[model samples]
Target chain A: MAAVNFDKVVKSFGAFTAVHGLDLAIDEGEFVSLLGPSGCGKTTTLRMLAGLEFPTSGEISIGDRVVNDLAPGERDIAMVFQSYALYPHMTVAQNIAYPLKKRGVPKSERGAMVQKTAELLQLTELLSRKPRQLSGGQQQRVALGRALVRDPKVFLLDEPLSNLDAKLRGYMRVELVELHRRLGRTMVYVTHDQLEAMTMSDRIAVMEGGRLQQFAPPTEVYRAPANRFVAGFIGTPAMNLIDGEIRQSGGTWQFHAPGLTLDCPPLLDSARPGPACLGIRPEGVVFGSGPIEGVVQVVEQTGHENIVVARIGADMRLTGRVGAERVWQAGETVRCGIDIDRAHIFAAGAAGERLNRPGLRPVEAPAVIKAAR
Target chain B: MIRRVAFNLFAWGIVLAVAFPLFWMLVTSVKPQFELFRRPPTFLPETWTLEHYIRLIQDTPFLTYFKNSIILSTATTLVVVAISTLGAYSLVRFKYRGRESLAFLVLFTYLLPSVVLIIPLYLMLVSMGLSNTIFSLVIAYTTFALPYALWLLRSFMAGIPEDLESAALVDGASRMGAFVDVILPQLLPGIISTALFTFILSWNEYLYALVLVNSDSARPLTTGVMNMLVSSFNIEWSLLMAASVMMSVPLIIVFAFLQSYLTRGFGAGGVKG
Candidate 1:
């Protein structure tokens, strides 16, 4: 295993830029995920590291060696494509043994290595079958076996679980995490699924529009996002953000919108008194009596919890997560309270900088925010 | 039940219509030469004889022509298929300044009629002193066969997913190594079909063989068999029929072996499945 680094890497296709000066460092044996939506350059970043693509500028290094000029095979990296690109022409044994054969492993040694890989993946009984004969999950295992048999310096998986059914995806998610722990290889997984990144990554590098939005631990990304984009994109129900203006009234700051007003959290020392946005997680929007009053719009019941969306005025809607037992009907008037301690404040506009929390990293937090804003 | 039976009858009628000539050729090759002038031609020969086949093999220079045809067709198929397979792969996969235009140019060459090209090709071969040789026919046949094979294989090459090559590259195979290991296997059916086509084209090509070679030693079956009908004082119908039946044997054998792959090759180029 080796540590991987993307030193101010940028990738562009003619007039369009796909990844914009990305600088990420991953430690050896750490499970890092590049997470974003489609066209967000997460896969491009992974491919650059795997040597499938060359960065337009900057350098990519694996284990302290600059690999900008190296081919994928020369980089000693193995990748599992999203399609689980197992060779349809070869049986499971040959598919797993392909890398070893390419590397000039002797025939006898290749047999044992393939046998051991199949055993590790619980594919011993199916080693003689062609790829078409295997089910989706079984083909996935064979793809993994092909990568694992090489014991390469790094393992790059590009949305490997996206093709499986729901239950199989969950199972493979856990299996991947367990496999990462067992092998302790430096694995860079590219995925657009937030749940997979949240559960499996040691540190999640959230990206959008070809730029890295936030790179921190999953809990850190969830609890204190670097910007408004992270705050809106990381959660399932999505954090409720209301555009308003904050002003210093007397000694404290108050946020004022069209029909609702709330005192700013006292912890926000850097909360500039100007136009800003307030972000509240669904769980933080309490449904008890308080200054804010609204009519319930919709309530989505998901077995153990209820997601209640309430309209505060002519336009603004706040969603709150509450226990399933105590539910509010649609069109019912309800008094709602904003959990001030858990609220997030941001400078208002398209690219909002977080006004509440201090920036996490000087390199990632300030320059990108300044440039984008 | 009546509709099904009627459909079956119509299908069988069309099949028989196409197959009757081949059946008559086989039957005529074994019929006695005197049976040809019977008042009403027999559907099944009243007297079967192998004299035509024996005489064609022993008395005529049929074996020499057969060897020449085999060499020419096999050589043309091998050379054309090999080059076109690599050319189509490069056209489909690699990026270069003129790649797309070059592929279009290859199809453009295929669009040109063979009769329009034969004169210039004959002059080029004569100037090179390659006339009256099987090698000359192989080179002349490649003019039409190469472009046809490349065009057919290009679509087949495009049907293979790009991810498979990327997977092979990441699995420690070089670009060319990955092509040989991954792509060649996937392209086998396409190669077989293209080879079969090139072989048949070279085998049945009468105009080029007639113009390029006049010696009995270098003559292919298409022109060589026609020579027997026209050059003789009286046309030997039975011997010519025997030669026609012999000329189709290689094609029949090729079809029998690669019949499944032929359908698959056509299907793969059209739809993904």
Candidate 2:
């Protein structure tokens, strides 16, 4: 296994830039995911690492060897495409043995290696069948088998599980984690799905608009996002970002929006009292009794919880996860409470920097109001 | 139910109308020379005789012309298909300056009538001293066949997903190695269909064959069969029909072998990926 490093890499297509000044270092045998939305540079970064696309400027090294001019085959890397890209004309056995054959492995050894890989992927039974004859999950396994037989220094996967159904996607997600564990190889996974990145990565690199927004462990990325984009992009039902301004009042800070005001935690010395945004996770927005009141607009039932989208004022809307046992109807005025310690404050814009520090998360609330169970 | 029946009947009527001449050619080949001017033409020969077919094979230079046609068509098909397959692959996959205009130019050449090219092609062949040879016809045929074959195969090449080649490249195959292993197999059906078209085109080509070669040794069946009817004053209809039947046998065999791929090739060759 090898450690992969990108040093200030930038990829541009003539006038348009895809990735800009990306510097990421993945440790040996670590599962690092490049996560972002579509048109974000996640796929481009993975392709450059795979040697399918060369970087416009910067150095990429696999285990101390810079591979700037190497062709994909010369890079000693294998990739599993999102479409699986199994050779339609070749059977499962041939598909798995393709890399071995390409590398001039002898006939006898290729058979054994292919058989071993097929067994590892549980594809031995389907070895004689063509790619079109197999189901989507089976094809995915064969694609993985093709990559595994090579036993390259690093495995690059570009949304390999995106093609499968939801249940199969989940199952394959666990299978991929197990595979990575068994092999103990460096793997760089590129995915737009935040759940895939959060659940399987050793470290997640959150990217947007061709720039690295944050690269940290999954929990850290979730608990302390680097910017307002990461705060809004990483979570389900999305983090509620209320645009407001913070002002110093009576030695503490108060955040004010259109029809809402809340006491902020003790600010850091660098904290400026200016235009700032408040970010709270859906779980942090309690639906019982607190300082602010809001009318419920829509309740989305997801079996285990009710996701309530409530209008706090004429403009601000908050989404809160509440118990499914208590049904919430539209136009009902409910008291809302923001978890002050857990809530994040950011400078107010799309690419705003996170203002709240993790060290300041333990401050007590201004009031003793409790949320209903 | 009645409307469906009428539709079926109409479709069968059209099929039969198209197939009538082929049926008549077969029937006419087996009939005796005396039955040629019968008051009403016989749908089936009353006295079936293989005399016309036997005489045409034994007493004429039909075999020589058949051999020439086979050589010309096969050579044209091999050379044109080989060049066009690579050309279409490059046109569809590679990014280069003038790539779009180059593809458009190929179709532009195809749009030009073959008749317009004959005189200039004949002059060039004569100056090169390539006139009256099978190789010359192959070259002449390529002038028309290459563009047509390339245009057909371009769409077929585009229909193949680019990801498959990327997968192969990452799997340690060189670009050409990936092409031989991944692309050739996917393009086999398309190549077969294009070959079939080019072969049929060169085989049935009359104008170039008539103008370029006068020797019986280099004559293809289309013009050679006409020579058999014109060289004689009597104009033996049975002999002409017999030669026509023999000319279609190779195509019929080729169609039988490639029927499944032919339909698929046509359907996919029109749709761009």
Candidate 3:
């Protein structure tokens, strides 16, 4: 296993730049994920690490050897594509044994190695079957087997589970984690699915517009997003970001939106409060009683929880998660509470960098606020 | 029920209309010489004769011409498929400057009629001392077959997901290795169809063969069969029909083996999900 380092790497395709000058370093044997939406350059970054793409500038090193000029084959990496990309014409054994065959391994050795890999992936019975005959999940296993049989220094998986059905995708995600633990190789996974990145990576590198927005553990990223983009992008039902102005109301800082006003989180008082964006996680939007009031516009029951989307004004909407037992109907007035300690405040500017409250450590925010100051 | 019957009848009508000429040729090839000039043509010959077939094999240099056609077609197919496969793969995979224009130029050559190119090609061949040689025909056939072959193979190669090759590259295969081990296997059906296409093209091509070759040893079946009308007074219709049937046999066999791929191959390579 090898550590990967990217130093100010930039990738451009003619007039369009896919990846800006980006610096990232992954520790040896760590599973890191480059997570972003489409066209956000996450795949481009992974491709550069694999040596499939040459960076326009800067350096990349794998275990202290600069690999900027190396061919993808020379980089000692294996990749699992989103499509599985199993060879349609080859049997599972041949597919798994391809890298060994290419490296001029003896036929007997290649056969034995392939058998071992197939058994590891529970594909021994499928050794003779072509990829088309296998189911989607089976094909995925074979793709993994092909990569595993090589035992490359790093494993690059580009949305490998995206093609599987939802249930199978979850099953494979856990399997992948087990596989990573068993092998203990450096793995750089690229995915647009936040949940996948959250559950899979040792460190999640959230990116936007070819720039790194945040690189931290998933819990840290979830708890304290770096900017408004991360705040909106990382959560399910997404974080509710309401645009408003912070004003002094009877000595307490209050956030005022179109039809709702509430005491601002203590964090806002430290900053030069003007126009700011308030980010509250769906789970942080407490129901029952609070200063802010809204009429429930929709309540979607998702078995474990009901996602309650309430309209505060003509255009402003806030979604909150409540237990499935709490019944809410459209047009019912409900008082909502914002968990101030859990909420994120971003400066109302183009960058929208997160603003921290005074006297609170960066990593530790209080669980509950007595009242918003 | 009536609509279905009408549809079936219409389809059968088109099939028969297409197959009738082939059926007529087969029957006409076996007809006796006495029935050749009958005022009203007979659907079935009164008596079948093998005299024309016998004459074609024994009297004429038919075997030599057949050998020449096979050699030329096989050589042309090999050369065209090789050049086009590489060209198509490069066009689809690489991001080099002028690639789009180069692809456009290849298809542009295909658009130019071979008839318009015949004079210049013949003169060039003559200057190179290749006139009246089978090599000249092979070159001419390759030139005409290359563009469409490249076009078809490019689309087919493009249909193959790029991620497959990327996976191979990251799996410790070189670009060329990935191509050979990964891309080439997937392109087999397309390659077979292209080979058949080029083979039939050169086999049936008459204009270039007629202009470039004069010897019986170099002449293909298409031009060789025309030699039967030596004089209008002695027009060997039965011999011509027999030779025509023999020439089509190879094509029919090829199509029969590859009919499914042939129909699908045309529509296969253009779109990818």
Candidate 4:
């Protein structure tokens, strides 16, 4: 097992930056995920850590040693690619045995190791069969088994489960977690799917536009995202942002959007109101019994759950999650409430920069200069 | 239907045009000596004879020429195939400064026509005392064959995903190990077709063979036939045709056996998407 560290690493293809000044520390035996949307540099960062791609600047280290110049094999890291690029000419047994054979392991030891891995992956019966003969899931297991047999310092997976169907992806996600737990190896997985990141990772590093947005435990990231982008990316319905003045209405603070307003969370009142964006998660947008009102625009039914998309005003929409039993319909004006304790106030001048509660502010956000008096 | 029938007739006319010389040669080989001068050609001989084939084999150094052709062509094919495949793989897989330029240079070797380079090559060979040797012919054949082989195999290798080898590399393979295990096996059919082409090319080549060779020792069958028919102006047309018949037989048989690789031949020009 190894601790992988990337120190201010930057990767560029010519002038176009692919991964920008990424610094991360993945601890031994930890399953961390690099999560983001496509083209967000998650794969490039994983490749750098795997030594398949070189950094344009800065350094990377695996365990105690600096592995910046190490070839992929020398770094002792194994990667399972999305395509499950098995050697087509080789049988399952040979494919799994490739690493050992390359290491010049003796024939008897190679046979033993391949047999053990194949059995662990439940590929014993398919040992002599070629990759084409195996089902997709079986080929995936072989690709994974090929990595496991190496007993590498770290396991790097570049969207390994993305190629599988949804149900199989879920199954393999659990299997992968179990495998990591059993072996206790450092594993860094990359995926654009937020659900995969939330379910599989010990820590999730969320990225956007080639830069790190937040790196924290998955729950923390989902609960207290560092910026607007992280806030919107980690959740299912995506957090709602209604842009308007944070005005004092009848001496009780309220979050305001055009043609609509809400009772503001008490925690936000200490700071003077200004042009701010009120952020609330769809789950926090309650179904009934508060001042906020909207004409129901659309109701999406997903079995036991309901997603209500409503139009509160011209050019503004709000989404609320309710039980499927609820009858919120289009053109019906529905009363709802915001869980004020969970509401967030971001400065418009800062443009979605978080108002980091109490006496402090984010270091990047300077002293308040433009708040409405 | 009318256009289809017209197309069929046109195609058959072209085929008959191409096969007419071979058909005439075959009939003349078996016809009696006097039948060759018939006012109108004898489509079928009144009396067939083995007399021309027997005389041709016994009177000429046919066996020596046959052996020379096989040795030079087979050796050239093996040498060219072996070297070009490795060279093509490196050019395709490895990225380095000047790689594209180097590939252009390999292609440029083909642009140097044999006729223009023959005098210098012959002078060099004579100085090295290799002018009439089979080894020299192998070297000459490589000059013509290497570029095509390299171009063909390089394109074939390029069609294979680099991700395949990267997967192997991460699976604990060295770069060379990945090439041998993952990429080379997929290239097998391409290499075989390349070898077959080079072999046929070297087997039929007569330009360099004629220029450098002064004796029967290094003469391949094509030159040996020409030398015999020309020197003996009162040539036995039947015997000459019989020799041509024998020379073409091996190639036909070889092609018959390896015809499945026409699909594999497509692997060379190539498996380009």
DockQ of each: 0.50, 0.51, 0.53, 0.39
**lDDT string, candidate 3, B145-172, tens digits:** 9999999899889889988888788777
What does candidate 1's lDDT look like per residue over B190-223, in tens digits?
8998998999999999999989999998999889
Q: Candidate 1 — which residues are off by over 4 angstroms?
A: A248-251, A266-274, A358-373, B261-273
Off by over 4 Å in 4: A243-257, A260-276, A288-293, A346-353, A358-373, B1-57, B97-140, B208-215, B231-236, B261-273
Which pairs of residues have clashing backbones in candidate 3?
A: none
DockQ of candidate 4 compared with the true complex = 0.39
For every model shown, the clashing-pair count is 0, 0, 0, 0
Which residue pairs collide, candidate 1? Answer: none
For model 4, residues B1-273, the per-residue Cα lDDT tens digits are 999999999999999999999998999999989888998877989999888888887877887888888888889989998899899988987678899999999899888887998888889888998988877888888888999899988987887777778887776677888778878787877777788899889989989989878688888888888887756458757878998999998888777767776674453322111
lDDT for each residue of candidate 3 in A124-193, tens digit (9 for 90 to 100)? 9999998877888898899899999978899999899887888898899899999999999999999998
**What CAPRI class is candidate 4?**
acceptable
- Choose 2 or 4, whichever is better by lDDT: 2
Better of 1 and 2 by DockQ: 2
lDDT of 2: 0.88
Q: Candidate 2's chain A scores what TM-score?
A: 0.95
Note the residue pairs that clash in candidate 4: none
Higher-scoring candidate on TM-score, 2 or 4 = 2
| lDDT of model number 4 | 0.82
- Please write out the lDDT profile of model 2 over residues A1-373, one tens digit for every residue: 3899999999999889999999999999999999999989999999999888899999999998999999899888899999888888788999998999888999999999999998988998999998877888888898899999978999999999887888898899899999999999999999998889988999999999999999999887888888999999988878899998999977888999888788886556788889999999888898989888899999988777788999887788999988899999998999999988788888878989888777555433222111111
Model 2: number of clashes? 0
TM-score winner between 1 and 3, please give it. Answer: 1
Cα lDDT of all candidates, in order? 0.87, 0.88, 0.86, 0.82
Displacement of residue B210 (Cα, Å) in model 3 is 1.9
